[model samples]
Target: MPKIIRDLEKKIFNTSMELFLENGYEGVDMKMIAKKCSIAVGTLYNYYPNKKELYIAILNESWNDTFKRFDKLKTLQLTPREKVEKAILMLYEDIEKRRGLGKELLNKNIKDLIEDARVSEFKKALIKNMEMSISCLEKKEAYKDDNSINIRLAEILLVSIPILIESHRHEKEENIRFLNEMLDGFIL
Candidate 1:
């Protein structure tokens, strides 16, 4: 039964992902997902309550692969600062690599609905990433006393990078250089 459930979930995910990519979030609905999966609306709702939940499930699955790469960064033997610089570059490159999905994340149409628990889970994962990345720097220096500061800094880096990318869209290398230069100020 568990196998059947997992298979059904995978089917739903695959169908919803294709539909979501072809149509924006608003363009797809629970009914459409159910139809695409050839399942009843109740069955779809049993797995995912609404369109937002469906979208979040799809996003969570997609991010699982990226999170693996993020995990691997921690195993590298570079200095704290170098790890951060690489993370910054990795973040930038990941955004570029998944530009379509990234755009959906910041898409205006779904902005209002993105403030849900599932979205919060995604945000928390990112914050944890930031904290891990920053903890390396904190260990080098004794100034890691404040938790809020680290949180804000993480928030800033994540939010600002996408905006920075937009303005420096023509020059990706310049963006990396600018981010690395900024990161240098954080190191002792």
Candidate 2:
């Protein structure tokens, strides 16, 4: 897309997230997003096609930003356990900042939308990041030598940690304590 269109999409996405958080998905409409973004409704449709598409775009953007953060964590020289801990903390901090919007977004049934090609690449990147983290943990002997358990644990943590953070947004201290205890069981 052209720079202008890309910029507009971002604006629309951010505006939609805020509106959805404040009012909820069913309460917000295309016109509301356009008004908040200071764009024509037609212009918004030019990029998104529909409200569901717009919502999915927001989710994809959020997921991509998160994956970028995880990518950055890999550059640090920390141990496998430390990498996982840091990644979890980063996710927690981010979710805490956007907890309301995130809760609203997560309330949507996005199973089919997330499987779309537009967002699938980010999903793959997330899986790759998890696999890399698990590999590092295995190398450091944080996990048993059994490949199956390592794979399962990696998949579980990759999917669960984010959901856990989002679910426990109101109980952050307790959630962090539980999360750290879970991590401690695997770390040496």
Winner by lDDT: 1
The per-candidate count of clashes, in order, stands at 0, 0
What is each predicted model's overall lDDT from 0 to 1? 0.74, 0.67
lDDT of 1 at 68: 85
List candidate 2 segments past 4 Å from native: 1-11, 23-28, 35-40, 100-112, 139-145, 162-173
Number of backbone clashes in candidate 1: 0
Summarize candidate 2's per-residue lDDT along 38-101 as a digit string, tens digits: 7788888888888767766676666667778888889999988788777667766765666544
- Clashing residue pairs for model 1: none
Q: Tens-digit lDDT track for model 1 on 67-100?
A: 7878999999998888888888888887655444
- Cα displacement (angstroms), candidate 2, residue 126, comes to 2.1
lDDT of 2 at 90: 71
Off by over 4 Å in 1: 1-24, 30-49, 100-115, 138-146
